[model samples]
Target: MTEESSDFKFNYFFGLVNLVAVFLIVWFLWYIFMNPNTVMKLYTPMYGFSLIVVFLSGIILMAKVLKWPAWYNRLFQKDKPITKGILLTIIAFLLMIGLNYIVFWGFIGKFGIAYFSPDSIVASGGIGAEPFVARENASTAIVYFFTAFLWMALFWDLGFGRWPWQNDTYGVQAWSKLFAILFFVVLFYILLFHSHVCYLFYPAQDKAAVTPWWEELAGTGSAFFSLGLILCTLVWIVFSDLLWEGKPWNRYEVDGESTFGKGFVVFFSTLTFGIILIFILLMIFNYVWMEPFVGGQYTDGPDWRYIHAGEIAGFFILAAFIWKNYFNNFPNLDSLWLRALIRSIIAVVLGLLIYWFYYSPLATFFLAKVEGFAQPGDTPLVWALLFLSIILVQSEFFDGWPLKRKK
Candidate 1:
């Protein structure tokens, strides 16, 4: 809004670059529309490298400008570090919603114009459809949340003269917590719109504390993949922070400084990653037999293959969480082998729990009910695929005749 702010784009030169990119995209589209062969050919790592720099720079800039909580919240209330962010986000969401309403509902309502119909938004370049309104809103909201979350963490670490949260030093841990919160804020927008595909679920039988609620919640395959985005970001952030600090690992030992768990989590999860093959097999049968087997009011997963997939995926997820919590992030324990043992055990336990809880019910639901009373498969191939997957994950051994071996 200010002259300097506009010129600086808060702190990013990429605002100019983004504008240029937009112009280029439009031109490219126009060119393609006019002539099939007209196209911009950009082939170099540098092109990608430049975009990365632009992206990071824009994040920094937007943080400076849009950081209402970081600036205004700090001034008004000294307590509750996240208050500023939460309040600012609520206001922003309401405003975006209101604007959409005004454009579609208010002005259009009064004028009765075709331009204001939900269809009009689609025709004029808004997100399409009744269902996709949520998807589009969520998608746009993701961009907004990422800008806010990543920027807040970026600035706070810079402001506090501390490393980013990923560094895990005691001083910067506060920022890490804030960073995690911000990441979840991104999830909020993601789930608000597309709660269906998240693959979250609850137990149909109910009241079993051991039951995985996340599976129930993931019913429609709307698996809060947004959370996966944030988690992946954190994984990279941690890696980058280590790289920046001349440390190869995110965590350091107590007696001295050493990095132990570099590829452990990745390898550990991968050991059990073979579940996918089984899931695909069951999915085929789920479509074939589930409706005939289990004829009940199931939501989007009428076939039950997806439901079973949700169950099995839950295992890897549980193992990942456990490996993260108890071992990769162990307390009072700091040896590679020890961490490995703890993680592997936790992972197996989590894995078994997933098998017992989700896969079992889903299998029964799909295989037994066959549209009238039962559902999913009778093929040895599907079971064989899954059996092989378990071995693949357990061995944590994946290499290829033409490929590199997994660590």
Candidate 2:
């Protein structure tokens, strides 16, 4: 086979495998039904050892099995461009996120005609529970998990894009696609768990109870400190030389670099703190914590509370740290900064456009009807970052993040 064709075969092999796994999961769910303990056993780690080996081995097969040596290389390689990967990833994310909202609205509203029903979603009855958020843990899992799967197919294209059926290469090297997809599948749930999303309303009830999974897995209070250790190790590994002038300890994006330092710190700080805070918030606010469930075995939430953001949360934290170490610091905005700024702008515009086109209708249908749900601050910062993404994309990819740049 030609090189391109060979690559295509490699890419799709895993995609098919992942699809089969998903299908099996659905069929299993359809057959035996929603056994919380069974799913928990599949996901949970024991005695600080993780089931990551199982899940990652199963889901993470696309990269190694495909023999794509370029997977990790694309991220840290000194020569290969990372911007194209970023653009594709962001675009893919926007599509994924937008679709999730659409699908969610569809099931909840049953098209534009109906409203959310907990009974339908949780299989208990209807959506009118007072503390909706507490009662709908399963709802969040089902909606966001599958929405993320749709996104995974895009990333799989890279790793297995060279697979037999629809082999193609666009931006990233074919080897790295699987990691890209895996990251989002994990990340979306993390975002929702923290935000306490569309499950029901705030202060949920009746769903189920959680145990102390994270507090147990994290080995108690050392989550952040251990993250600090990982950050230090990566910093020293990448920029061990004295010539490394960038702030190895900081977090933020640099031009033509992975923004590892900033990203990792963001990963751990924001990501870890997001989960940690969720626990704290739920415990302190009795009304909010158990709002979804009516009242279960434990008045306090269960240990499963921390799974979404647990082990790999620090990897993202490590990623940002690495980015910073490589790029050093932000540019003066002369050659690079402008492009970075423009890329951010484009992302916002594209994101907003997608939101307007796809997500808006869904939101209007199901979510819009609910008042007091909108939290309206930070419009400027969010949009400004969007503009910054535009610039970053230009700086990284087309030599300038601009409207006029080559598509």
Candidate 3:
């Protein structure tokens, strides 16, 4: 076999092995910490842990986006991939904890925004005043913050392809991108999330934020609409970047370089695609669960429907990542259209399977979730994000480790 063929075979084999490994790790971690069947039995800690993992992902992505800073190089420049992965994972964990407890909860939460601190939330009273409920809501609000950050981070990385920063050094590029992304993330969070969160309390913090603008159209004042929309956007972003090899978008280049105009087009194009994708998914769910009525609970609730659509999209995103990184994104073929079509179908099928299995009795047995679909205070996105974070850590921090055959 040619060296290329040999490499493909090698990756295809170990990729399956890695998939199984990741599945077990996800289950074990869930059981140990987040499982409702176990001591935790609450969604607050689950969301908190999910935030940490996603924060870890942001840090890891930042390292790569910046092309590895001098500090990172000095620390891990000589270490093996596995060792580097271990050390970085530990550091990421600690850093997230500090950021959560010290930065958000301790400082900003205590002195500035009460929403970031569960204690403050509870003391204030109103809706979700119970300790567990308050903490869960606080963590979820923060999760939304990070989720927006992740979306912007990936958008700049893949959609922009280092534009505007192309001529800058790593440090300059890193800070510029980080601050710019943060500006948008914070803006989006305030507009999209803060209002909904403000209303989650009793009497509603009408003074803190304006009434949710989408409440009239969406039938609820929940941020799930934003969450679902963003996650759907992510699905197309990943689909374009990985399965299509950045085609169509990359083809918009000028003189062999990615241009700001092209990147702007990419931004709005994927967003439009995301809107279409979400509505399609919602239609599918409508067929499955019947049309969701306003104020109805579970699968029948509009809020749940929107958020669940996002959760399902999260599965598609994970499947796309897994397909690219682990499965060699199989069916390497000559006809580009045919290859893309088959891969899209495969990824959707895989995502559907994941969605099914997550809501199935098996997940309840393993993950200790409530029976049936769209259970209150339970979200599959947390699990999906956790799984994706592991895959990212393996690829970014570990350098593909055991999966990367010796060059």
Work out the TM-score per prediction: 0.27, 0.28, 0.91
Question: Model 3, range 121-170, lDDT digits (tens) per residue?
Answer: 88887668888877776787777777787778777766776677778776
Q: Per-residue CA lDDT of candidate 2, range 1-407, in tens?
A: 12222222223344345434433443343223222234432211110011111222222232233322244345655233455445443543454334333443345434421223333443334444433432233333343344344324422332223333223452333335455555766674344232233323333332431322333443332122222232223222222111123233232434423343544453454334444544443344444454323222222323222221221222322223222222222232444435334433433343344334223444333222122212221011112122223333333333221212222
Order by TM-score, highest first: 3, 2, 1
Candidate 3: lDDT over CA atoms? 0.78
For model 3 the local lDDT of residue 34 reads: 75
Evaluated at residue 400, the lDDT of candidate 2 is 22
Question: After TM-score superposition, what is the CA distance of residue 376 in candidate 1 from its true location, in Å?
Answer: 13
lDDT of each: 0.34, 0.32, 0.78
Give the 10-residue window scoring lowest on summed lDDT in candidate 2.
43-52
Better of 1 and 2 by lDDT: 1
Report how far residue 250 has shifted in candidate 3, in Å: 1.1
Q: In candidate 3, which residue pairs get closer than 3 Å at backbone N, Cα or C atoms, i.e. clash? A: 127-202
